[model samples]
Target: MSKGISGGCKCGAVRYRGELSDISSFRCYCRDCQQLTGTGHSEMFPLVAETFQLEGPSREYQMAGGSGQPTWSSFCSTCGSPLTRRSERMEHCLYVHASSLDEPEKHKPSRILYADAAQPWDKPNLDE
Candidate 1:
């Protein structure tokens, strides 16, 4: 029963709301995340999939995940803002981009994933 959270795309064309899940937030340095965010990694937070609701114009792109399962990246069709990542391997939670939250500061990444795939220029902050 965590507090509810809400957010949307850059252009306000897409919006989502959900109750936070008990799952710890995480930072992912996987190549998919790197390419998606155009950064060293992506900040992600989990929401209870059963409580999640989305609205407005959005699109999704599917790709093979590190687990070799189908993963989908959702974005705002109008503003092209990255919104969420869903994997067939993890269906109970909807992973939302931390930056996409209405209060991005609320996101606190507790662990790092795919650190081995980190780039030299943007190494994972192990100290955090």
Candidate 2:
């Protein structure tokens, strides 16, 4: 198993610790992510739904997603920083922003998703 990883909400109000899953991470250029983050693309770090544990209750907001469905977004109510995103489909697994992890640097992007939605000006630095 890989070394354990940790991280928390932006306001430091909530925290999490767990074994880093072997799942691959990616940069998403979907409209949902671009609008939520005000960027051309957003980062995703997916893992087994049960591998993560939240130390505190998270504040969430449901908004109209790109698919014209209700999407759930959570954050630290105090810090107002993005934390996680959940699909309207109850069966789908949850997705957490890799940046919200306690150790963001520990993550490495494996690829890009929703390339069809990529912005014209958001040239990514492949070296970063």
Q: Which digits, one per residue and each the tens of the lDDT, describe model 1 over residues 1-128?
A: 24799999999989999989888889999999999888889999999899999999999999999889999999999989999998888899989999999999767789999999999998888455
Write the residue-wise lDDT of candidate 2 on 15-65 in tens digits: 866564465678888887887777788887665456667777678788877
Candidate 1 global lDDT: 0.91
Model 2 TM-score is 0.76
Model 2: which ten-residue window has the lowest total lDDT? Answer: 86-95
Candidate 1 collision pairs: none
Name the lDDT of candidate 2: 0.72
Q: For this target, which candidate reaches the highest TM-score against the unseen true structure?
A: 1
lDDT (0 to 1) per candidate:
0.91, 0.72
Runs of candidate 1 with Cα error greater than 4 angstroms are 126-128
lDDT of 2 at 42: 83
Off by over 4 Å in 2: 1-3, 63-71, 88-92, 124-127
